[model samples]
Target chain A: MTAADHAGWEVVIGLEVHAQLATTSKIFSGASTAYGAEPNTQACLVDLGYPGVLPVLNREVVQMATLFGLAVNASVARRSVFARKNYFYPDLPKGYQISQLELPIVEHGEMLISDADGNDKRIGITRAHLEEDAGKSIHEGLDDSSGIDLNRAGTPLLEIVSEPDLRSAKEAVAYLRKIHTIVRYLGISDGNMQEGSFRCDANVSVRPRGQQELGTRAEIKNLNSFRFIEKAINYEVERQIDLLQDGGTVVQETRLYDSDKDQTRSMRSKEEANDYRYFPDPDLLPVEISDEYVEAARATLPELPEAKLQRFVAEHGLKKDDAVILTASRALADYFEAVAGAVDATAQVAANWVIGDLSAVLNRDGKDIGDSNISPAALAGLVNRIHDNTISGKIAKQIFEAMWDGEGSADEIIEAKGLKQITDSSAIEAVIDKVIADYPEQVAEYRAGKDKLIGFFVGKVMQETKGQANPGQVNQILKAKL
Target chain B: MSLDKVKVQHIAMLARLKLADEEYASSVEKLSRIVDFVDQLSQADTSDVRPMAHPLDAAQRLRPDAVTETVERDRYQQNAAAVSDGLYLVPKVIE
Candidate 1:
């Protein structure tokens, strides 16, 4: 059920996202941070915590964190502490994780997310702290044993926490997507959910519509996809509402979403909460950020998504929805800008084709904007042909298909397939005359005030010319002749 | 801040330690003492003092973003108690 379905209840959600930073080396070690290497290969002595080993803070992580802070208009703490959160699992070799506590790096930020009604809503950011990631535990391929891969043991991650301002699952997803776009635009993280670069944990609770006290919450962990995050939050909200309606109080716990079952199951309870015994790490020093460093990082920031979307609408004369789609990704926005620059006067038409046809093909093929085989200039050439009356939109689509199949450029495909529109006025008139003469009955009806018969004559003329006749010219000439 | 026997057992469980029944009492006492010592430091009035996270007030030293390490899968796996196909194998992990 949607949030609206529960009439008198408010579903409150807060998201804690762990975005892996795009760094070449591990956060505390000189080990390669490349994904999908052989197991245990990237774990250095420091990562493995061999006796007498120490962790040196990575400077790139701090810069990227500061860049993200500026992107969200957060305060970049001049002095932030790295504390050790003590926990134990096979994946964590050091028996504790180095993270920020007491004083985090970035705090008190806000991000704007659009609600389902397309109205902007601001969500408060609590804090964004840098931490080291745990290793991977492989449970497959072993009948009675599991394997540990420490390749990811010391990777750097920025844990961005959001306030409980999201009212529904849709709002939560919109907020998450906004964060995803920001990180990608900043070039700090690849934002690859499938590869575990970006992941979220949702804290969900429901209270009476006007209740001031918050209800008990359950944290659903490790949601990697947008679809799963939506479904899991919806399901969890429904579960809590049902329990409360049945006179049962909600229990605070940690849950894991089973995507296959489409339900959440309890992983652990609050009674099992780790003390964490957080304390400052003795080895690493405080991360001090100078005003000069903050300015430099801020200078490196790219034009964000909202500004780009507004520019696309204002400068390119695109509709709001069209601009939103065009600026969904930085690469796509760049591609649209290139096409618009090449096809100057008809930038709106270029926006239509890019957002409509190009997006449809990319979605169908499960490809990204960067994966398109059609270059920006090639699409510009096709749009220019349509604009200059060299080819009809229908034939342009065929040329696009051929271009997608690697046939050749738009000009080459149009020439080789003889698909150019017949702009010769006399030739089009000849086809229209023959079409009218061949259908005298329809023409007589057309003269009897049956203006709809003009459609029949146009279809016949188009068919006679093998769909290459200019449609606008055919309509004008067909009208004058009758 | 003092850790009870039950609290000590819970901590041990979270840490995945298989503490023996005879060890819980001594472990609780030792952990309680450590917690009390840390708690004593918090009793002083330091409202004017800033919470310090590191000993030295130095900025982090940065290295260039480059892959400078070589893979030594076999050599690294040599320290594992059990291994198969270059992976460190242990007891089965259920989810």
Candidate 2:
């Protein structure tokens, strides 16, 4: 529950996400756009804004913006103009940043996000415009001097703005994750938050529950992670509610979320808001995209996250939650489909193993599905063994661990360790007889109306066979004997 | 829309420029004239006119996505006033 529940206020949130486009060079300059490069190495004369240099548009950036617009079902403007937003900062060598103002590339798009109740909530995408990124300023360990790295300068970015439609922090995260999945599916960005490839700024406000007008908003900037976004919005919402309860008005300003302190503080007041002196950039011309261009780009779009999730449920007959988790990432979804096709396992069983054990191991090791050591074929082999009763699910887990440790394939490990299930009726009968003899007192108790003691006999049978006996057969034989 | 000495000083501060006291008056006058000239365009009725962002009617020209330039850290950093460890050093920025 949110603080709004008690305070009788509702939280409203919108997100502005800046995703660095996946391009080999800077947007305007012929400079390498590779991350982690030596400082200033990628800064060309145009990037540095030399006196006589002008910007030429990067074609891939426009295509990427169009592709995102198509993915989100947005209207791709046929003509978009670039404007110069004037500001002065050390990191920005140019006095102004080239961005979209009056005319953006994409507008009026909507995305469907699954809320906490598993209901689809549509979030309005206000606009996604193209812009250039600023460089970095490092202020650590400098002895009153700051280091400037222009490597990120001139990098192409798509600033996707959202309408203030989210009611809670969880919804905001869901929206963010949906966008992250879409971008990754499009292969337009690495979507690495830590590496600053995808960055977020949240506009948060709170008002009385029945109030129609929105309260003043505070924009929390540079939220790089999903956890931070949720935490920061929650904190900001609480801060606003408390202030309003005490008859204080929420201040409209820019705040920075200090992750270490778990709080937000004022970065700049409205008075410090830059005029920006926005005007059309004279150097670069307006971008014109044709219908055919958009159609071609649309044809190349991969199956989006929502469609994939629906298909995973419809075709695979998987649980909705399981399908959502399996289709969270494209690679994991592909892995599941491959394993399901290779083995004779039911969709339910396949989903359980993949979402249960495989995800747990991946999470524990801090690895992505793409980095898994267990190949899809090997996992399918293991599942096939379980299907054929060569091993029970419990015993297969041990084989899975051995496989993860590079012991061998599932079949090879089972053969080497002699861990196959004892499904033969005669062999299981022998184990059950010994178990009944050893548990004679419990058996007498069971026959004298202690039906619960059957579990004790089953345990003994399992221990006698070292958990290799088929549990179903053991239960059947034990019930008959009793 | 109007320029004055105080507003000029604030602009200079935002731009990170230092102007002598004697130069403020002249700078304010020059900027005011430019603004006044641009303000004249507002007098003409533009309700039916479409807004234009660029003088040229050409669309944006796009280049193929490829790394066409090599790293030139030393040469690029040579343009900075001060540099150390492949970074451009400036006066400490608090935030």
Tens digits of per-residue lDDT for model 2 on B8-34?
Answer: 988887776999999988899999999
RMSD of 1: 2.2
DockQ of 1: 0.62
Best by the lDDT measure: 2
By summed lDDT, the worst window of 10 consecutive residues in model 2 chain A runs over A1-10
Tens digits of per-residue lDDT for model 1 on A1-482? Answer: 56465999988999999999999998888898999988888988878877798788777899899999999999999988888998767788788999999789999999999887888899999999999999988887789888888999999999999999999999999999999999999989999999999999999999999999999999999999999999999999999998998899987888999999999999855455557888998878777889998998988899999999998888878999888887778999999999999984477888888888898898888999999989999999989998888899898888898898899999999889899899899999888878877998998999999999889898999999989999999999989999
State iRMS for model 1.
1.9
Docking model 2 quality class: medium
How do the residues A315-432 of candidate 2 rate in per-residue lDDT, one tens digit apiece? 9999999998888889999999989888897877887888989999999999899999899899999999999999998999999999988999999999999999999999999988
How many pairs in model 1 have backbone atoms within 3 A of each other, for residues 3 or more apart or on separate chains, i.e. clashes? 0
**Candidate 2: segments with Cα more than 4 A from true spot:** A1-6, A115-118, A268-271, B1-30, B45-48
Against the true structure, candidate 2 has what lDDT?
0.90
Which candidate tops DockQ?
2
